[model samples]
Target: MIAINNLTFEIGARALYDEANWHIKPGEKIGLIGANGTGKTTLLKLIVGDYKPTSGTISKSKELTIGYLNQDLLSYASDKSILHVAMEAFDRQNQLHTEIETLLKKLETDYSEDLLNKLSDKQQEFEALDGYNIEYKAHEILAGLGFSDVDQERKLSTFSGGWRMRVMLAKILLQAPDILLLDEPTNHLDLPSIQWLEDYLKNFEGAIVIVSHDRWFLDKVINRTVESRKGKLTVYAGNYTFYLEEKSLREEIQRGEFKNQQAKIKQEERLIERFRAKASKAKMAQSRIKMLDKMERVDDVDDDNPSVNFNFKFTKQSGRHVINIENLGKSYPNLEILDHANAVIEKGDKIALIGANGRGKSTLLRIIAGADKTFTGKSDTGYNVTQTFFAQHQLESLHLESEILQELQTFAPKHTDTELRSILGSFLFTGDDVFKKIKVLSGGEKSRVALAKALTADANFLILDEPTNHLDMQSVNILIQALQQYEGTFIAVSHDRYFLDNIANKIWYIEDHKIKEYPGTYAEYEEWQNKRKLQPKTAAPAPQPKKEEKKPVVQQPTEDKSKQLKKLNQDLGRMEQQISDLEKEVKQLETKLADDSIYSNANKLKETNSAYQQKQSALKQVQQQWETLAEQIMELEA
Candidate 1:
């Protein structure tokens, strides 16, 4: 656990945190959220001791181990297998393995009590730490993260940067430190991988503080929220949605208080001016003047800037059949990603394309966007369907040497510099920020620039791939609202369930080389999938003597099924116990909270309140898991 006390961090003349105070508790999951340039990553560095606060202290528990996963992926030049890299997380276990091997060799050479004792100790420690299961767990985690068993043995250097980041992430999760600090851990992950991480972190025993842009992931994984803003930190007792509501109320209250104080000051000033010359009232006027002078001015509340005003100007409306594809087939030299695919995109259709990674979602988008002509498919756009394609790597298309303003001008050649600046401001780039070179901009900044340029294009149809990849939560919401209002037909491939749920009117789910169209939002599609899963199976076939002889073939599957059920039952028991323990702790905290004297101490009150909330959150999570397991057990029994 770490405590940030009166922390003041500054860069040049800008104070990011001005005497900000926050407490991080054990076993609490917190989502660190803010807009770009709000120092979320800087706070993580401060907690990890990589950066010192300009003033004040970051006190940490002496025995706590903190694991930090930075945005930069580890680059391995050596031929270390991916599994070996993950296994490196357990360095102590590896050392014990080596010691035990050496002791065994020595015993074979010459028997000695010392060697025997050393071997015994090392073996016991290894078994206690589940050393024998390390490799199996590593593979299991890798598979869950979308890496195949064969891929685990491949050299780390063979993987893409995104996949390599997964390798690093797997290692960090294996370490299981006391506090996990992850900055944009979902940046490189696809949808399935993000879901896997959410499940893993939900059951993680230690504290977690993650800064992520994925709203659904944050909502599912974190119990508390912290916002970093203009020279201060604000803590909310619940997740992102709760934070939004509480923050709005807080701003409203602050604004009201400020207005009231200003009115009182104005009244006092008028009274003083009117009574200054009256000798009888002069003393009273002076006292009122002193009171006004001593009153601490209320600062204006901070809020988001005006929402970006965005509207799509269509060159021409597309025909009813906006896009039509027939017998679509795409393949590499050794792999056929898509085969005999067919689909149609009607005018005004807002489609969300979703599937596991490498399932041809992006490839299909490319074919439809006319960016990939190599595919064997009759893909065509309808009459007057001008399209603007924004790929996942679209930011790379920005001219790195050009300023943001200049790039915007390139797209809108007739617009004057003043007009360009106004448009740039709409995308949250104002003042000198527009003058920054694209090379110097952060990923989020570049993403905004790409989006701005995309908006300036003369197109009626949009094809976007992972459009929300590098955007912050606010920017994503902005884009979502903009798309909602746009009249153009669009197809977007995104991992953000929240965004898709908000904007997608139709779901085109890609799986096993085919696209299945569902006419509803992502939430509706989820309901359909759940219902499909719960349908009963057909009756079993009648048994025969020859079928009995084939029992050996099916016997292994039954044993594996039994093992899985046993594990689930064990997990259920553990969760039940955990829920009971957390309930007790919550009661204890509530008792302490009832002590009115603690409210007088600001630090004690904050700590006690945070502890109680954390306990309640932990209990809720455990109870949810318990119910989930109970349902699964019931289904298995049935």
Candidate 2:
């Protein structure tokens, strides 16, 4: 447990926190939520004792171990592999293991009984600490964080900064400290990796406080939210969804109270003014005026809304067929990226392309955008298909010397200076921010500016690769809203689940060396996945014994008993096979349903759905037969 009392932190003239009091209870999952510059990260530093508060005391139990993961501070040495870095969490265990090994060597060299006993005790302690399984545990954590088997052996220098953050997260998880402080933990994770992390955190025994702009991740992980706003911290006892609802409700109540107080003050002032004009009620008037003046006025709430609006107005419309890909293939010598892929995109289609980190989602986007032509694919843009490709590396590709506004102006020539500034303002760049050089911008700021430029291009078809990367929740929501309202076709690869849920009508799952399409929302995809997981596997039934040949046979009415027995066995076999086949078919249909391409093909999907229904009906019939056969088999065995 950690407690902060009368915390007041100031940097120069700005007071980041004023008499702020907060406590993180044991086993609490708290999400630190706030705007870009609201001191969320600073508060984490305060809690971790990295920064001394200007005035206040931060108290914690001496026995409590704290682990803090700052995204920016995470780095890996060039020579170290991902697995090696992750294994650093078990340094103490490794040391103990080495000592145990040394003791074992000593025991074999005619050591005394007492010395052997000491060594035995040491081995017991090491085993109790799970020293033997440390390597396996470390590998599991790394793999869950998205490290491939090959990546585990590769040098740390081979990975990018984002992947380096994942290594840090893996280390933190493996450490298993009493308290965990995570800053943008999900920034480097893809959808599957994020899901894995959510499961990990859900089962984590330690207290967790995370600073993340990922709303959906927060909703799934954190149970409480601490919002930093206007130099103060407000705690809400719930997840992100509850926080949003409660915050809105509180704001409405505050607004009502403020209005009522204002009305009362106005009425009192009017009465005082009228009484002041008359000599007879001068004392009453003076008293009323004093009461009115003495009343404390409520401070105006800070405007949470961004000042500028982002309105992307395109100049032209694309043809019905926005983009067409025919036998698209890419390879790097021995490595094949995309193989014989074909897709036809239409206008007004909001498609989300998803896969693991090394999958060909980005490569496919590039081929469609015409950024890469060395592939064997013929990507043809329809007539009037003005396209803009927002690459993942767009921020790094910007000219460092140009100012933020200047960069936008250069890319979007049709936009006036005023229009460009407004767009930048909506993305949280304003006044002096617009004048800041592109090189000086933070990763998040640079990403926003790149997105602004991409949106301003007036493209009918937008191919964006991880557009939500480095963006805060508000900025991401703004982009989602804009994309949802846009009349153009969109093909984007993003890890933000909430963004995809809001903006995408279909999803293209790039897995198993192929692009599969799925219709419906992300929620539907999850439901489909859960159903498949819950489905029972097909298992071979236990063999039955043949009918015994007895010496004494009871004479019963003449009936075709042999024929009946044969028919029963055949029926049972057919029922079992039918159920097994239905299970397999259902899995395949669910997989096809989750595919975006299959959903896009209406006729094929309709047929698949019809077949799926027929399978379900057949499964019901087989299930009835199975129950009957099971009873019959039990009776016969008896």
Candidate 3:
């Protein structure tokens, strides 16, 4: 529905697009991809009329409605509830509802024929717009995007920026625009949410242009790939994997053509040099020169080498057992997020922590990293185990006033300026970019800085939470390569399938307050899950020992043990619910504190902070109780 005709967009002296032409056909799902600073986002803006091309045209059908989900969350109504914001997407339907209400009120007063006719028209319009079920649709979209009913009712300001972006995305999807432009839409989503989005977009009835570093997401969601580089667009007929293969083949062919052309040019120059002074051969030399001048030079293909390499450095190695948790338990007041959990992590074990959002994956990581102190468990680090915890908020905690290079230097004060610069350069910070203040850097840039710091920390154990969220594909690949070769132990919470496939050798799946260990990659875990679903559920019990050989046992005691186990489980479940509820309240209050307007009102700010602190304290007490109960349960199990 959108046509880019000979588009040429320039920024000062830099040309982002030069006579670039591309088209978005109806129902075509295209992944817009390129290196960082290659104008992928700019291209989307150009299509959406946020930026005008220096020359040429981007024509769209007059009837087409476009929805653009930008990487940045700007001008959103923070005070409004998420559901309200989402419902605003159906403005026309809402207007019809308002009109119908007005007409009904007029009828109640003493309606004329004109008012009746107007009411009838509005009712028809409302039905056509599906106004009767707008609330249901909005709630469905919100729930699909991972928002609870209570969360939907909470003000948008309570959520983090990532979740706010999701809110915006829900609004766009609810609007059902003809063309959807998404830039890094999966950046903040967890695995479950990403899967939900994949399903939603797969069945989306519109043209989609998505710019994402998520290879699996691109492969699963898009039918085509569009690579924008050097102010030109190259279209691939298939998905991301197909694009890689086809692009490789095309490059090989181009190399051959380039080689042959170079050889011919060299021969022509040799002939010109040999016959330059002879009149008999002068015409021939002139002809060769003209041919050489007219020949088009082929541009070199981009190299895949990243500017920075993340070589995880460690000052010392940890003992065989990197981390050991026995009877680990954490809970909200009524919610038992984890109960009687036990796990032993060994040295060099690369574990991928996977689960639904808010299901304690990050919580477990924090506890392991020693960041969370309010947990009932025996958590012990092996000898000489130094850890670096790259939490989700790590980037936000960066000193925005510091320069990019300065940030890394602070992490590695012993390293000289030259060494620090070299490390920074490997991550793509070069020349002036190294000196650029962190405040001015983009989200991806800040992520790179955080990654660089993590690499320089010299820790033998790394606890990384969503490290690849803001990285580009190339950087992510470099990170995967580095992690694959890392000598240290790693426990990471990530949703990127490609990253997990390359890095994680074990999966620690958190489900229903327990950890399920799978000794394979994420793909294998998914396969195993799918296979389990297909297989019939008839698990055979282990055979009992022969009565003659079996030792005498206390039947009453055995029965009592079973009853105790069941009771413990039931109590754990209740405590977990209580904890979850309390935590949710604390989160909502924190979100309220996050609002700028709330801070401006001193009384409200104090009240909210006080409530948050009180909830935190109450949750801690309940967690302690849950932990004590967990210890008892663990003893019983033992």
Candidate 4:
């Protein structure tokens, strides 16, 4: 348990927290939330002693231990395997294992009773500490976080930053500290991994304090919500949805009180003014002024909800079919991402493409955008379809030397500066912020600018890949509103379930190298998928015992189809295992792609690109095989 009493933390002259109080009780799951720069992460650090408060105390019991997971841990690197890294959490067990190994070597030489006795004692301690099962525990946690057994054996330094973060998270979970302080833990996680974490944290025996902008995650995982706003730590005795309702009611009550107090203050001032003009009533006015000065004036409630007004109009209109894909085949090394897969994107289709990481969601987005033309298939756009694409990588394309206003001006030559500033304002950049150079802006600021450019492209079709990355909750809401009001067709890949649910009318997911569609919102898709998964499993009929004399026999359609489908699925599973390796390799290559040393050099970039293409080619070949096998199964079923 930890108690923060009258805590006051300051940065320079500005107080990030003033007289804030919070008590993290045992087994309490708390969601720490607020706008950007609200010090949510700082508060967690304060609790973990990373930062000292300007005043007041944070009290914790001597037995309390904490496991903090932050963005900084993404830099963690080691030659050791991830399994070994995670096993490091079991300090005593690991120490005993080392000591036991040393004793075994010693006994081979001395063979003394004293040495044998020490070895026996050490073995007992190790067994009691579950030393033998430490590796298995580490593997289980890593698997839950989306790592395979083979991946656990790979060096930690070989993983991408996101995967490395997962390693650190696994290490923390293995530690089983008394409390967990997770900062944007889901930022690097895919949907399946996020769901796995939700389940794990739901049953976690210790207390948890999570700082994330993911509304759906908070609503599902936390029992309490703490808002770090207006330099105060406000507590809501419920989850995010409950906090919204309760905050609205409290604000309504506060508004009434504020109005009443304002009226009383005006009346008092009027009386004081009238009495001051009269010499005979001067003493009475003086007394009233003193009383008014001492009065406790109620503060008006701040605006909690801000509206966005943007009319995204395009000069051209797309045809009935926005896009059509046929016999699409894409691969990367051993990963058969999409093999002869097919899908159609009709006009007005607001689709959310989501799945586990490395599922080719981003890759598909690129193919749709025509940015990557490596796929072997037809990806045709409808008539008069002017399109815009938004992705995390586009942030690097911005002119760092240009001001925010200038960047938009160059991108939207037709729009006036005033109109551009208005668009920026809707994204929470106001006045002088538009004048600041893009180079000086933070990642979130650059993201907003990039998004603003994408919206003003005057395109009827949009292909957005992870557009919500680096955006805060407010910006996400603004995007949701802008997309809601726009009359355009778009497909986006995102892990933010709340954003997807609000903006998408259809869900698109890739499975076994094929793109599948659900004509419903994300929530509905989840329900449907869950039901499909929960369907009762029955054993498939075995092949009729060997036919006598090699005679041809009629086959049962249902049983034959089931057998074929099962075989096809098993093949897909084997391919997926191979994909695990290629996925990691591709991620490593991508991490290299983001490196300045590689991209800044033409030769190195060319070499990396060539190697990348080779891997992709290999993956596509395997993916094509998937289509071959799948087609056979489909034929048998037909």
Best by lDDT: 4
- Tell me each candidate's TM-score: 0.80, 0.81, 0.79, 0.85
The 10-residue segment of model 3 with minimum total lDDT is 534-543
TM-score of 2: 0.81
Off by over 4 Å in 1: 73-78, 272-289, 414-422, 533-638
Tens digits of lDDT, candidate 3, 88-189: 999999889888887788799886898888888889989988899999999998998899989999999888887898999999999999989998888778
TM-score of 3: 0.79
Model 4 score (lDDT)? 0.88
Clash tally for model 4: 5
Top-down lDDT ranking:
4, 3, 1, 2
- Highest TM-score against the true fold, candidate: 4
Which parts of model 4 are misplaced by more than 4 Å? 537-638
Which ten residues in a row are the worst by lDDT in model 1? 536-545
Model 1, 1-638: lDDT tens digits are 68999999999999989999999999899999888889999999999888999999999989999888987555545479999999999999999999988888889887888788888999999999999999998998888788988899999988888889888889888898999999988877887888889999999999999998887899999999999988788899998889889989998999999999989888888999989989999999999988888889998786584475645576577654578676678988877877877676877899999878888888888889888899886786765588899875878889999999999898888667876676677778879999899999888888889987777777788898988988888788778877887888999999999999999999997766766677789988877766665654554543444654856554665688798899998897677567646655765776678789998999999999999888877776776787678678755654
Separately for all candidates shown, the number of backbone clashes (residues 3 or more apart, or on different chains) is 0, 6, 17, 5
lDDT of each: 0.84, 0.82, 0.85, 0.88
lDDT: the better of candidates 1 and 3: 3
